[model samples]
Target: MNIKKGLVLGISLITLFFTTPYTPADDKREEKGEEKKVYVLDDIVVTAPAIISGNEVNRLGSQVTHVTMEQIQDLNAMDLTSALRRVPGVVISRHNQVGSFGGGEGGAIFIRGKGSSRPGAEIQTLIDGIPKFVSVWTHPIMDALNVDIVDTIDIYKGAQPVLFGNMAFGAVDVQTKRMKDTGFYTGIKSGYGSNKTHMASVEHGGKTERFDYYLLGGYRSSDGHRVNADGELQDLFLHMGYDFTAKWGMDLTLIYTDNWADDPGPIDLSYPSDGRFNNDDFFMVATISNNYERAKGYVKFYSDKGDIDWVNQEGTPGYDTLTDYKNYGIRARETITPWQKGELMMGIDLDYIRGKARFLHPVDGNSAFPEETFRIFSPYASLSHTFGSLDNIYFIPSIGVRHLNHTEFDSETAPQAGIILGIKETRLHASYGKGINYPGIYAKVQDNLWMPGDNRWSELEAENLDHFEAGVEHRFSSKLIVDLTWFYDRGEDRIVTSPPPPFPPILTNIGEYKNRGIEGSITAIPISGLSLFGGFTYLDSAPDDLPYAPEWTFSAGFNYSPVDNFQISMDTQYVDDQYVTSRARMRNTVNTDEVDSYFLVNGKISYDFRLTGCDADWQVFLAAENITDTDYEQKKGYPMPDLGFMIGFIAEFN
Candidate 1:
């Protein structure tokens, strides 16, 4: 670890020394009205500073979906699941009603048919470029990711070793809001919906000459659609930034979430009692950044801690479980234009995690909790070159590699490359990459205890994936744009559960799978104040019947403002039939069968008004989800709510 750190530091220093100095001549030209143009990364699209760029998105080497704050507001999204479902190639499954406990433990997001029932295994979630996942289960808590506090979300649908290390089948980077102007602003929002659900939030931000800060606090509660399926959640987010110089700055972020829910056991179960669980989580990150004319860099340190408690009320004397987890990490990255038409990026990541799970007996004493610790180190680099245009066409190519070292497993390397060709308003791109996912703590422990005879624990290795993709993007006119992409992924030595006759299931790395899909999207502004968008996806997988791997998914939406200060929007989504297995199916207790395909319609309307004699704006809105009241089951025995409505008002003061 020390050696790796030393090497990173040495390289940083050398790059710093070789950086081209800012020249007075450049400043003079700018002062004389010759503004320097920003060089955006090829094919990348972003509304804020990020590791990737619009050029990168355009290059089509990798498939990316960029969601902006405006879009979130338009949808009136409450959480990650709602916002992400609108993206092509992305599918989110939730159990029970909207805010029920099953929504957290049973919910999952699949990107190009890659995600598993487990959380953090298939996709990695990041907050400001720092990973956020429970150390104990190694999965993301979707409820904890409040959409209100986020400014933008960048979704990468394939391997991204250059910017993110392991578990990058699908990666999401969430950037929070920050104050930019030297003035104070505040906002308040509140709403109510079906099942006695209610939500409220307050936010404030300000910026001064050298400092800026943002704060938000919110709460949501619901009496779920099902019996004994109630839940409540509270969250807080804070961000502060300070500028030390014109080219250097530092930022600090803190987030906390408290959630409690009651889980109604599976529908087929005859149990009369309800199981309950609670989670209290906290996260903090501090970063220092440098932004020069031709270079950018940042160093960050982060910590996450969570406490979980669960009570199973299936029997007269229920059992209780408690789990505690802690994780800390450091991340550093630098990007520099070392020469004409060329850019280089390098980064390093280090993480340490510890967790313990305990079972408490009511009459007897509590059992000893097995505590475990893990450490990981990763270093990576990427280089890209842009070839000058020929006949008004431009070409760019890039290559990257990442090496990961795990304390308990063999080290591995991931490599990736891509090329993009662009002419006028059209771009064609292709890319190939390798990715890896290590065994989660739970998988590791289960292998050790249940598979001791086979000693599979000692022989367990990281899962590997190879990804290939090609795509094209075009802007037919100022009013219309379209994107189409095709992707293929192959996995080997995947960790899966094996249930043998008369024996409990065990974790083993003996699974192989394949997924191939085509995703397409189009956006059009047919007239002033009117916007239309639609997306569709087609997926084919090995085992051809993998549950929740929908063969077809489609969505279409439009936003229109017929008059000033008023706006209306509507959207519809359709999903094709897919196989699914429920507790009843597994136990042969009932035949729930495959999940039936369904279609849904949603709509919203809002109007803005000014506060006379005050620097403030007030808005009132009404929104409805599942307006069609479609009967659907993303998860069996967990029917979704039928036609939920919310009425809310927002006041923004400047």
Candidate 2:
């Protein structure tokens, strides 16, 4: 599809979806409804970020982070990277203030040194366990993920080979909000900040009898800190659902995003700059789920399509480029409790990826590449059972495997096992899993276009990872909690350019590395309406110069309501010096120069007053970021913005 056509469709479709009538047919529908049945994990998708709560512990032996809507509001975070910055072992690289730019650190997320490679990333982005990314490129497009409808974001800190297929080395799950109350509601919020930054969003949602729906639309823009750095995002999300019966229901979801950001080249580096990276992404998901006393399951079908336009590449052959891609899949899982304290889960996944790219102005004057496609069918299952003494002591041991059936490559079965020991409110867990990422068509595009004549991409193999993790959490009291964890990953068979090429450009799977780290966090509610949370991480990576892997990081924050209708929140963080690398074709080399360590502080304060005649309130808020005015860089030579602030207001009513 043409880039212009895709952009038009994205904008027009979003408008149409958001304009759907709010009122349901048959206005007199019965209001009586049965209590909702608890759905299994296989059916209920979720999202959160930073410091998972003790009460949310159910993953047995995995490390997870949780951040809620209230916390996101407190942080005044506008995107995934900002919202998740405080997550342990997490790092992000971005060149602009607003949207995520193109490849090469323009927009990227990393976890313990993984996911740094664009077009072949290990970290996966998901919405309700459904995979969402650049199908042809094989990595996530950050701009495509719209945060306007997010209720929470959950970060699973390591490989989840059994539960999630493909790019499961690490994962981010975004859980959209669902209406709970029986009355219709509306919300509006807008803000203006430093660098001509402005944003506005509105939403409507409600639950009625056997029907429920949520709809949202938003826009954000900024004149960034540097020339050609401006960016903007427009998005819409809608969800409609109806209960077929007390135990079964169905939901249809639509999400669309059109966003673009420009790259402001490094100050110290002299290179031809790529001016802008634009994207139009859309997604549709349909789900049918059921719940019963001993069994729960779901079947989901999803399609995600996107068009990326590389507006400029000043000196490269591909001066202007466009790539169109789509990903579609069907997944289903059944979770059953065959006997008391015992659970079994079985599931299957089928995925198809395809796309094509064209250079509007190739320096070589040749701009055609045939479209390609890849297919994979994965089936997995796991079982867990609890064992323990009469009281206060018990452990759940689990095991599972996923067989990858790829149409273009040999298959690999990912195996995972774990054990979780619980002593009352304190729990200890350990787990190990294997992860695999097939060499998608992205690799093919690279070799066929850049290799001139020697295309070794056809011989390239899949990358593999062996991961192990262990942790312990102790809840001293309902008001205080602490958790700590350590992990090690062995990565091998990674596809890479034949190093320091002198004559031939060859891609091989000889790359290998080991990464280990320990991270811990604590959350405390010292007094009524006051929350305090802190976390720290230490990493040791061999081939030690891993890109974006910092040695030490720390974060702490507090939210307090000192008086009625008034609130205050403050957060601070520190990042260690780290190397910046590049993954452009044969230029895949780690930069020796390290970006220096830096400290940052951010805070927000708000006050709310009820509207006189309606069940609504308007909240005015003030937020400040980089309060220390520290000069730092996330990507080498890309200096961050100075201290700045924003003023905003939010209103809601039923």
Candidate 3:
């Protein structure tokens, strides 16, 4: 059905569900000598809390943003791309739609105009502090991680702290849910919208005196808005924990995703006869944590595995490529209160990875590729001191360093320092840090395959980055808060793909890039039931060739509830003109870059209610995205979908 019909049908269903007649169970209860109880809609309204607590935000030494589960639900976000775009200084690129596969080529996220042309390269992604990406290629598959089980997301815009290692130019940390109370609960959410898209999810969680468990499974499929673009995804996540004693505990997490997509190619080209991509990814992590009066620590072991296959049918003889990768790592960290108002932390990390790539010829069935293995060890420490308050003012300073040892490269050291000053309702903070990015296995193996006797591989060195940031936050009153931050990053010896005369393309460290930007945001509660939020970013890059780096971006939104049980929310985002390389031009002839810009508006309405005889709280919501039906492209030649609508209901029971 078309979007218009789907929206009308969805609204009709919701109204019918709310107003349908039913036998009053309270009457039967009264007949049985029990008191009749009535529930008012006012009591059912739920107001979401702030994304991050004030205390938590103040304790961090770096620039950070948090997205809570409540906010995710309010936005009707089904994936990371949808949810992360709301954050300042973040931009996301998707080939066509969610669940589509483009290898390490589909989606890219840029932060402060710095991101790898390759996916997941510029930013590090972690789940519960464990890295989540293909170790061989050093990139993440957006669809491989499920959003249904997430409880919160923490985003670090620039160089991360010492606790995280390896690629930390920017970081995204995903935390899953854990049972809070000792009771069983189950929920199901389903929705349908334009482009023949549909989604369904089931979740259950329970806790006992000594143990707790949570599980979620979901599936999404869509016949995309473009021709030959169809995708499907199935994901499952499980989390369990056991408390052996008051001070010791163990927990385990497992995730699996199977995704498939058919590439439609560029809009300017004819749809291929057969173009498919498939991936089966798995991740598991187990941890043991201890809590003592003076110290706390955890030891964790994690494993990630991925199997992918891609086929191109446009060739004379359709060929397919297959990749298999496995990565396992162990991490340990301890935090100790060394003295009054002082703390120290230390950690160690070890990782091992193996990967193999195969190219299959349709006629010969000959598949062979090199298998590579690598190991890494890193140790880090940090110290912090909090001085006694003077005249109601507080001061804190911290420093940290990490030493990395790699099997194939020279050792490297990274250092960071920061300070925070607070007085009354205002805070001032500044920090400086250094980060490094090592070459991935793909580059090493590809060098061996294409250039057997070249010394270019050995000459490659780890890229380095220096970050500096300062910010101030003020709470004008109980209902208003404002924040402003400035950041500058300089990168040296950056890796770039170079195709020199009479030679194949090779990875080399031959470029330098820099970015300086400022971001500001405000949150205000004008009245009891109304909230307002808005943010803007101004970015400047040294080079003019940076693709997809917009100079100006702004977002504004508000939530209001005129009635007790009904809420209305609206948000708008503006992206200034940015450069993008044309996908179609590259394939057909010489590559060309183009500039594009767009504005998007979205709105939602929700009603909360509880049936008189039911023990569940229900919320029905309708959300419209891109209401203006603006025609734009995040990636040149790949036009994003026009106006879309989704109507869904959420139910919770205990």
Candidate 4:
């Protein structure tokens, strides 16, 4: 079918299917006649960077999706990465090799088919309001670890609240569980999955009259399916809170993560596509946060660092490398209510980041690519006003500016405006925002440092984007909630690496490019004990296609609990044609064809039980991924494996 025809038919089919009701699952219940009772919608979706507590499923918002703790646990997910797969419009790429012990190339994620291929640094990850960077390009430090201590994960598919940090090309916020009021509590869990994958974790937390604390430790290992691809991971998490009084409080958190395994480098399936390599990365972070409700303000200070060791490069010793990074920041924010239905939020944020890389001979270590450091000072604010319940109208306007001291780059500003109109059970919204991205260490090193004739380094401007979106959400009943959104984005002056010429263009400082696109998603739970979620995205870039960005992508799934404590779930996604690399000359070549679309399946079952002195539960989970055993690559030439499974248990003590 032609592109236009396909698009029309796709929308018609989806709309028709949703309009027709299905049999309600007996397990579905209503709260005060509200259909969205199973999950609280308002508490679920994070409207802005400011942290708000409540049930997300019931939260009234636009272009947002939330995954609750119960939803994560019921699936018996192997990691936080997999736990987000069920979220509509979100695409998660996983390593397919059975023996592949470490999480590597094939593992990644994309939101609305944007920023997925770029190093993960562009995608913002917030842990309890603190901005987090995952080893520059890879997944978060906690991606491979267990989620035993997590409370919930909220995804804002577009520009989010101004306080979280201006880095989110596509926003993701992760919130960890906190210590309860109970005197003391502890829990432990163990599980076994396919490929000899075993996992275990211990978590405990308690609250004293003046202080509260929580700690979690976990370990996971596997004898991977690939010949040399086996590895292990260890994780540690700690959180503590102190209440000086009813209006003053402080919270602190520390995290340590480590992963090591044979790389199992990419395969050239057409040639000799099998080889073993080594991959190891370790990360750590420390943060402290203080809040004063009476003063209507808060502040935070934190630092993050990491190192990577890649044993096998395509063919060079300089290919072997270790990198270090340090980030320090301080932010102060406050909220004020000038009128009954109007409020203002303002903040000042300052951050300094520095890093260095050491590589072998072929890396040209003698070049002028010295260690680098940069600082950003940003101050921003927003004013929002809400009408009465009858009108249910909300209008918000905001702006943020970043000043970069190094590279002699001038400052840049981003502005945003959004409005929401609620009419009984239906709500409509429209928003426009801007985003800016500065060059990272890798960009500077490859472009300006090595290129002999490229004098445009200092002249390169930070990439910028103008985003616009409009959508509507309707509540047909308590059990049936649906949302549809349309977005158009224009990218301007995007820094891109130019190809090498007679003098070999520098690696870091590239020229520029542009991109534009449309995207949307649908989330619904038509019946009790069952939920159906799906989403599709369409994108057209200036260069025909963007790397790792499928022109069209989608996911559909359902979850059911036939009996108490026993649940079953399945989900699948279709990613249309996508480019593995950014080279325009080879964009349509057969080499990139390996990363075609495929289907994946997951399932599980858990039983609740108790022993004297122990509140325990046993869950047996079986996840059959790539059920057809189709050999496909989510990343170029990186052959992913087929058909795999896992099983696990949990016990709590007082």
Best by TM-score: 2
Which is the leading candidate under lDDT? 2
Backbone clash numbers for all candidates listed: 17, 9, 0, 37
Q: Please give the lDDT score for candidate 2.
A: 0.78
lDDT of 1 by residue, 451-535 (tens): 4444355556888889999989887875667778889999887766656553655455777778898988877666677777888
Write the number of the candidate with greater lDDT, choosing between 2 and 4.
Answer: 2
What are the C-alpha RMSDs, in order, of all predicted structures? 9.5, 5.2, 7.9, 11.2
Runs with alpha carbons beyond 4 Å of true place in candidate 2: 1-57, 315-318, 389-391, 499-504, 583-588
Q: Give the TM-scores of the predictions, in the order they appear.
A: 0.87, 0.91, 0.88, 0.80
Worst 10 residues of 4 by lDDT: 25-34
Local accuracy by lDDT, each model? 0.71, 0.78, 0.72, 0.54
Clashing pairs in 3: none
Candidate 4 residue 161 C-alpha distance from true site, Å:
8.3
Q: lDDT at 271 for candidate 2?
A: 70
Ranked candidates (TM-score, high to low): 2, 3, 1, 4
Model 1 stretches with alpha carbons more than 4 Å out: 1-60, 96-105, 117-120, 267-274, 313-317, 361-368, 389-391, 447-454, 497-507, 581-593
Q: Write one digit per residue (lDDT tens) for candidate 3, span 1-654.
A: 012334323433443343222322121100101111211113223454322322123233686777766667777776777777767788777665656465333555667776644522767888888887776667777777667767777778878648677788888888887775666655567788788887777666666788887777777778887886778777777788898998899999998888878766767775443467788888999999988878888999999988777776554255887778898989999989999888898999998877888777778665456778878799999888887583468888999998988887767898888888879778788888787777777667667654444537656777778999899988787677788999999987666656655465556777677889998888777777777778888989876556666899888777788888898887778888886641210111222455478898888899988998776668888988899999987766677889999888876655
